[model samples]
Target chain A: MDGTPGGLSGISAPGRVAAPDEGVTEQELALAARNHGLPLEALRYDVTPPGLHYVLTHYDIPATDADGWRLTVGGRVRRTLDLDLDALRARPATTRRVTLECAGNGRARLTPRPVSQPWLVEAVGTAEWTGVPLAALLAEAGIADDAVEAVFTGADHGVERGVEQDYRRSLPLSTAADPARDVLVAYEMNGAPLPPQHGSPLRLVVPGWYGMAHVKWLRDITLTATPYTGFQQSVAYRLRQSAEDVGEPVTLIAPRALMVPPGFPDFMSRTRVVRPGPVPLAGRAWSGHGPVTRVEVSENDGATWTEAELVPDPAHPWAWTAWRTTWTATPGLRRLTVRATDAAGNAQPLVAEETWNRGGFASNLVQRVEVLCTTEATAA
Target chain B: MDGTPGGLSGISAPGRVAAPDEGVTEQELALAARNHGLPLEALRYDVTPPGLHYVLTHYDIPATDADGWRLTVGGRVRRTLDLDLDALRARPATTRRVTLECAGNGRARLTPRPVSQPWLVEAVGTAEWTGVPLAALLAEAGIADDAVEAVFTGADHGVERGVEQDYRRSLPLSTAADPARDVLVAYEMNGAPLPPQHGSPLRLVVPGWYGMAHVKWLRDITLTATPYTGFQQSVAYRLRQSAEDVGEPVTLIAPRALMVPPGFPDFMSRTRVVRPGPVPLAGRAWSGHGPVTRVEVSENDGATWTEAELVPDPAHPWAWTAWRTTWTATPGLRRLTVRATDAAGNAQPLVAEETWNRGGFASNLVQRVEVLCTTEATAA
Candidate 1:
């Protein structure tokens, strides 16, 4: 409760360039304010800071002026090119530093919720990516051994419940043509360019997948042999229990990302309401998807679960994993829950199984929150 | 339910490594009874594949006939040094790759409702560490800013529940006096020499804690201001729930780890869950005392929770995160739980309140499991 949002040491900010959470420079970021926020000075990275960069691109705006931009390869292909950005700048381009989040960021927090883009819980970012290989242009546009999916169109507009929506997702054509594991097409980021709300000349980086399959302004690249639906596919990402249990979405990007599970927010005892004494149930867990093998804890709400001690961050296994569980605060009224499992056991879901569809994609489940504990009768 | 040994599988010669349902990696492996595999042998720049490289150390063995050895540093310091091995190889050394795991490599699956380490889970590996700075021998043993905690005693030996435990862990005197996060004593590893189960003529690497503060076979270093009570701090990393609600006992070494959520285990979902379709609930979330913000999921156990997609792979803050959720099989019986949260929100507890504790250190709670939902009339 102290990131000092108001623990105020004077509480009077007003300007860090225009602190609406910064970011507003690609020459003041306009397309009539692409969606607002544009003035932290075009951002380049100081650990992201610039109130965290911006770029959302998903609806037209593809006038691509990087020498007229091209990037289009053609279905399954035996050969059918388009290339531009000066033929992908004559091939070869590497740079990796990756990290990008935003598949509807937090999706209006969800709980049977819908209609989103409102994004918060930060929206998630981290860049460095530079491109070229779409599998060396799908081996000079010739890869078709029966293509097991690669679909992936994007220009972004929105409208899934009413139709229209133009952002797709599908992968696993061996991670859509690996190409030394870059998958790029990118137009540079973290070093500059590619701004028009992130997808200026071309996009689609696809490294570990899910940034909505790195679509953003990129246009067309079929390959298919199966799986790659519309409306972000079955209304974006997916995870609606009861269809006899789920798990067949997530076209390409792997690397599960999201955390905090381990006596979290435990002011004392699994948030035994919040206070009674020691409480530190804090949390955070991650693994680009293969390292976090375990992190479990719950306070009565989910009956019982305990197993926190998953430390791993040498140089970061794709990054993130921190934990702790200390409770002593047991007062009353608490509803805390935390779950995470990976090394491939998979867990996290308690509710939110409404596939109402609209534009909201893949809303995980099992995130209970309720806090307030007490233990201060000391001045006796 | 297919890990063999009663979990089925039987014998095999099928594909390679016996392949059979992803089972079969167990040839005893708790403390390696020998018998293991992976040798197609291929590497150019190496993305890990020396049988997955990263075995790490805190002493499992470090014997090769040692060319020489000494490396002492003396406690409460003013200058109680030792330095042999060629004056500690004439000062100055560095070779980084950093990655170590094994706080009991999965603690023998953490409870099928069991309690002693039979450890079949692999424990983890990854090498390339090189060492030198124990604050450069605690600044050649000059440390004494009233040191608050730096106890790392190890020569590795164990017996636990029946007593006999050596391997210690204790940090915090500002991480035993940081010098830009170094903390080593290592005597070469990937470049060779430093392998007696690993802790050769001295060890204590401490890159972000855990792996039990890298004790290994390295003699001692004690400077203490207090921390570390024993039994790995009272019974192997505890974290129970109920029974009065523990608050803190953990001998000294917190900052848990592990978060490899959904990325690796996909040979394309291996037959895509045998066709009954829909099943995307993945895991991995982390934070030892910081970063992983949110990764919620629960399908009716904690009643409700939905918030998964927290992709951060770099500025760990603490480290570990990779969460996913998309279940959809639907047939019957299935229970799971995961927990993690931090960036302050904290979380991770499904029950087992504070885990009473008589010995177990920090052992978190909330990781329920149960599955069985075949469908299609139990297939066809």
Candidate 2:
């Protein structure tokens, strides 16, 4: 970890633009090795298999004993409660198919490249999460009237940007107590006990929010009269313009669409090669702001757009909408792109640089795929 | 994918040393996003969970309809048989826990870097695979005396180095027909149907060999009188000293040991930090040559070594052996390394550069990790 030169100095530092020649730093590679994203082709599945779902862990997955694990709820509560797995399982369970995306999904595409996780557009996935509604637990614990925020603490402890702490995030008291929000203390993913990587035993599932708010290995929840100013909440995951100015906190995911890359990919360049004919292009689209209302495709890099058929799953409103279209590819190089507009009217930026920020949060740039159509017969 | 500057020209060109100032190219990042490696901390589990297992797909995960899929065994056989899922499932099934490591496992660690998948040491995982033995299938088809090799073809198709073709590889007739080898036409992984990324429906699982021999999405098996010289076989996955050197063909896995990186990691650098005390460290080790006979740990970067206790699972002979040791931590920084030796007398090289090759295949260099021990109380 020493003297291996590539990018900036130090283990964790404030965000900055990488030098023109600087390749991905070893630190970034280390993070990429531990975490993974959904393979874009996996967009074919409506309920992403747990293994195919994207994962981003801030620290080592803490070894946990499920039977002995307990969730403690205390601060500013009328009655502090400690609940084990069995106790939580005995409560009514709710399941929802939800899409989760990392706030830094398109960070690598940013021109200067935020010196963090160098993500492309693959950092999103959809899974069915099952657990007891968090609102029920708060009611049982009897939140105090003076409580203004609820801070959820996870068992995963680590350092980020030089600050050592347990991973923690807070929600406004109103949002935490709202039954319509449908937040859950998730214990299962895709019908099985959560795998260790997905936070075995228990975790938090905040619908329609970026992954940071859905803390894995959840251990405790504390209600506070004042805002929780932890590093994760106050410093990281924020959309900042520069070093001095405080930026807006990244929350709901912006609308975005990514296609299952057409044809087969070249092992190295990932340039798609398709036979000269009608190629069916399909993809998944989603938004945290609201349901995706329209999805459009462009074969000439967004010069002209055509609407695709949208098929939204009513049973899983929080999950992504499946869209499909057809293109008659000719013998030439083509750059294909896709974008989504939510019911709330927010659309993805045309390019990653449009949404660039120091922390590289929520840059839902439209996905562009390069395809070469040839008539030469090949082996298959 | 155009105009993205960083590395060498033209996608899928022959390997070469990257300039010192060159950062990871977008082409490499595309490959990294699609293929993922096992998380080091996941070593805590005996059988890595399906999702945690490392995956390297040569092309897109071909979508297969299990009910309609067929396995065709033809060419130089007494009888060409097309067996469907039901027909194959009716055959006697065998299950075994096997460890699969990519031939290019440590490619990224090499000095020049192969510029392929850019994998670190995490490109390995152990899983329980169940299916009918390949020897039984070959026996049923009745091999011809003149057949020198058995070619396995998969449904995955893509262009590599400008040649478009289906993914295919071949094994010697003797190796394919030897029941003692226990080669399997596997359909299940970790007690469940194979995940799409892992080759759904059916795939080949050859024990003791690198992952290339285990063809995924297997569709056809053709016997031939001559050795198969496909792109993946003759052009790629070969060890070469330079452009002109044909080099030895890569096969068996080399002995290697990787510890579960101790303590919590900083998000970006992954530099581990631990409290000053006795720290218990554990990891998994294995080799294609034979069972790991010994594991040694070095806290001062190989200045001195200490033997660790080895625990091999008798039931899973082809899987990795577990090893553990404890280190007394002082208040400072330390470089820790681990190496393994197999019963076959093969040992890992001390440095990655010692095993460097043009293709970056089978560079099982020793594992090195750095840790910081501090007495200061932190937030967590």
Candidate 3:
């Protein structure tokens, strides 16, 4: 327990990069085996089925019984509220289609990759989350004037970077109390009870922010007088260029676009193969800064771009926007790329190196696909 | 088209081994991200929820429209029957808790690992699948006398090892016609319409065979006069010792046991930590050969073993058996392991090398966990 960070032994320092050419380690593979990401092609579904939605569980999906679960709201609150599942369900509920993207979405593509979950994009999904608003719960509990942040603690527990504690994260009181933020104590996903991998009994759904802010397997909500300095909040999920730098906290997801890889894919390389003809290319675009205003596609590796048509869905303003375009295919290998720009003027970086960070957070590199078009009448 | 194994360029050979020092390739990582395994801890549930169930999709989870989709029974059948989702669900529905394990469950751990979806021990799950029996459907379709095999085709199309085709595999006509086999045309998982990833519209659920036999996104069932020699049937999923070996086809799941890793896991290494005391260890064991008759635990890395008590569930004969044992722990590092033996006398090998093969199939090595016990009252 000496000065070692998190007081654990045999743990790597936070944000350590793997040596160049070092492949994904067993540790990273173990994490990958436990967690999963959405298949880019699943974008065809407006609301991703819960099973296809990406999942990132830092610890075990705690075995929970909904009937026995209780959520306690306390700390700097005027009146602490302890409620059961039914009690919480009795409140007026609202369902919102919200998109959630992992802060470390494109981590593996980063050079000198940060050795964590090793995600290569695909860490995004949108689902209809149903629950009572967090603002309403806060109102019921009656927040004290001194409360500055709302710290959420989940039931799942494990040691990360030597720190042994339940998974926890905090939101500023300003964000938590704002009704427009649309944060929720979500108990259901896609109209069904939350699956075990998705925090089962109850969880948090913070629309328009990176996934870390939306805590799962929630057990307690404590209003704090001072800012929460937990490990996940103060040390991890930060955009830092170097180990010594105190970086800015990663919050909203950066603007990003991903095309459903056109045509059929090769099993090993996943390179696409298509028959020579007019190829209809379609994909999804999203941003937390604001609604995605524009989406562009490039068939020649970003040398030239064509503005794609955006299919607006007024019902799901917080979910990803659908975009489509047509590409006339001749016989040759082609690199296809897509990028999105949000109303706030935020656009995805053209390459991974541009958004490089020690922790690999907010890496919204443009999505690229290698496609081969052939004249063969029957080619997969 | 040149003499490449599957007529595809830049694709690795069917049974190629990755360089020993090379890390997991981006392509393998992409496959891993798209597919997922159950968290070992999730074994605590009797019936795994649909989202927690393991999935291995050879191609895209084809965007299936249940209303428009149809299942065709043709080939050597007396009458080719085309049925919609409603037609399948309207038949006598039977629900059974079946456990499925990928043939390549422990592929990643093999030395000179197979260059595919690098799975560990998590590639197994049990769910109550609801559907009409395949025997019933085949009986109604009236298989012709010459039919020797029933080839099942899924809608998912892709190129594998240079060969382009829809995902297809076959079962012996005898196996498909046996009512005792309990093969099913599954449309629901855990009482819900199958999730897109699990196979929407309809899927094939072969009760005791390896997951490869359970064709998902089912499109057709063709009763063939001769045995089907498709790529997935004849080349892939075979247990071969060398590249040239024709090898035996992998079918039934080998007996294996996996412990719900004791205590909590370190975030990076996944090493278990526990306070010094009597630690209760529990896990699930299953086999395609027969009901799991015995389970054993080893605290000293398989040096000595003790039998564990098996909790039987009469309803789920094809699902995993629950086993538990208690260990008195002192402060030190210990390697814990578990193995299972089925009624047919099949047992898990002690080391992975014993089960290694060129294609990395059926590697049911014993499950091992490195556990650290400490005197500290509060250690994760």
Candidate 4:
């Protein structure tokens, strides 16, 4: 056996040591291939732009022309300024890789799934966002001490919660003006001009917050003395702790992990079966609140837990951490689940039922998988 | 079972089906965990900085502080300019994520492994490189038609092939001045200043090329009227096609695929055993010459092949593609192998013996892995 890259020796070399046993069904071999490492089809693993971006607008996207696009900063500011696309691009541009996830990403996992956009975990993605920092523009406008919030408005208009309005959300003035936050008015995604589905021309990207804070098709930024009680801010994304509790606006993404489903593909294809043996599993874990500190996998239905290996470098402070583990098999069926814990000591729940709200948001549940294994005799 | 994210309903849910006959042993359960996915300790998989970076230097790294660092441009130029780190940063800066690999990576796999920094597959890594484009710097110095190549010299000096000189390599003048090539005089790695081992203040990063082209601790750029015959360029990295052939200078990386070894961990730990059934495997595929188009995995010693799923978005034009596949098993030792085919039609060979160089560089051999699978009865 040859030594590994790290100088570890005595490991066996790769190649066939034995042939397949006689009468092993052709279907079984295909099944093994099909059910291989994490199912790509089931996961939104793409971190680059222009891939499968989770579209969840209240209305159809409005076609915006670059010439017509303008960003206006007014309200509780010393100066009201209107700038075109070119003007914004002329500013000092900074690029950062950030992970954005829908606040309602795992809503479909709820028993009585919400009636709105039915999203599973695939609604999350990461990309390189390049543009002027929002703090720079806000600094030019000069904020008033009385301003409590900064409201961001998009061009897409629709009726929501019995109110006709453009898509808008507000951030606390502190979050809007904090340079360390790295919030940006983004015009590019993954080094290319933003696609129509992702905010084109301009969009407000509040890094470390859920997707709602990223107001796409951005048109205006308004500061106000009181908090903006917009439909999206005060109504849609509120997370209720219990039936009697008044919900609070959901902002940061909780610690969460999703294993690549077995047999994940680079592209969609037919399903394959699995043989019973040593199965390697992998997935990504992330937290909007803090860097993920640990991830654990449960093979006996969460009865006992073991730590999974986390990819050390988290690309970005806000990007997801890749992880892996294994599940040995017995010839029947088995359930595999994964949980994540963040630096803030927040651990993902076995079931995300506790965070369920009227809007069915913030479901960081322990994701589970079930697969069948067959013995050689039973298969043949 | 609920439908997968892609809305495919035919897939079955995961869980236990039936109990195995009185044979399966507890050791098999441990095997499942040990070979979980990509043996982290065995490979360098850091996508972020401060992780394991492959180091290969002929001499001691020259400790040059930024205060003393000066880049000089001369030879065949209308203007010779010497600039320091501060002056270099004054120019427009661009950041790109690119993968870098040693030309001698996988050199350990050669039949008669050459005497050098023995690298297996783990000598490769990807990082966000930030710096000013070399084209901009060259444009300032102006080039003449007589200039055929630009020689880049690093601070380290050593004796190689009976000559004592600083590390140096050259690129064609056209390639050195092409902005589309995305070459950079990189000063930062993964958002932070370059670490001491990674070139400290400055390095030359030629995207889509082997690590030898990235001259660390860069100090001088000399425009040459003819081809460079430096020891490194003439002897070390030359890829000889055959005994009588004059090997050309190696530039782009070949198509290669590496699977995360079963029992991969964040850190090295005890080896685990395997059960009898299906096993899932995954790894990364990449090519410096072109984007990886396809990857195939062979579980039965290469008797038959199956297409493994590739990670859809490559994140960068030059980044590696993630892939996965599965193996159905009978209770015995097994060998698994993976190969990558690039858009250029360059496929990894089953045996890399043909490409073996006297210096043992560029070994894209079809990687083989050996594993053991035991039945409950035999294992117990």
Distance from true location, Cα of B79 in model 4, Å = 59
Residue range B1-380, candidate 1, lDDT tens digits: 22232111211111111122222121211112111111101111122222233233221232223455554666677778766777776788865544443443333233322222222222333456676777767777887766676777665442222232456666666766787666777877667666444566567766534465677667667775556566555434444342344434333222222322211111101001111346665544444445667766665788887677765656322234456666655644445455666666657656542432332334445444333343221100
lDDT of 4 at A242: 49
Expressed as tens digits, the lDDT of each residue in A200-256 for candidate 3 is 889999999999999999999999999999889888988889888889999998999
lDDT of 2 by residue, B308-372 (tens): 99998898898999999999888676789999999999988887778999888999999888787
Per-residue alpha-carbon lDDT of model 3 for B15-87, expressed as tens digits? Answer: 4888978888888898888889999898998888777889898878898899899999999999999999889
Fraction of the real A/B interface contacts present in each candidate?
Answer: 0.00, 0.63, 0.57, 0.01
Candidate 1 per-residue C-alpha lDDT over A245-289 given as tens digits, one digit per residue, 9 for 90 to 100: 343565322222233222212111112123456666644544344
Q: Which pairs of residues clash in candidate 2, taking residues 3 or more apart in a chain or in different chains?
A: A23-B23
Q: Which candidate is the best by lDDT?
A: 3
Docking class of 3: medium
Rank the candidate models, highest lDDT first.
3, 2, 4, 1
Error of 2 at B280 (Å): 1.0
Instruction: State the lDDT of candidate 4 residue by residue for B299-361, as single tens digits.
Output: 776798999987756457766777877767665556778899998999998876776876667
- Which regions of candidate 2 deviate over 4 angstroms? A1-11, B1-17
Better of 2 and 3 by DockQ: 3
Which residue runs of candidate 3 sit more than 4 Å off their true CA positions? A1-7, A11-14, A377-380, B1-7, B11-13, B377-380
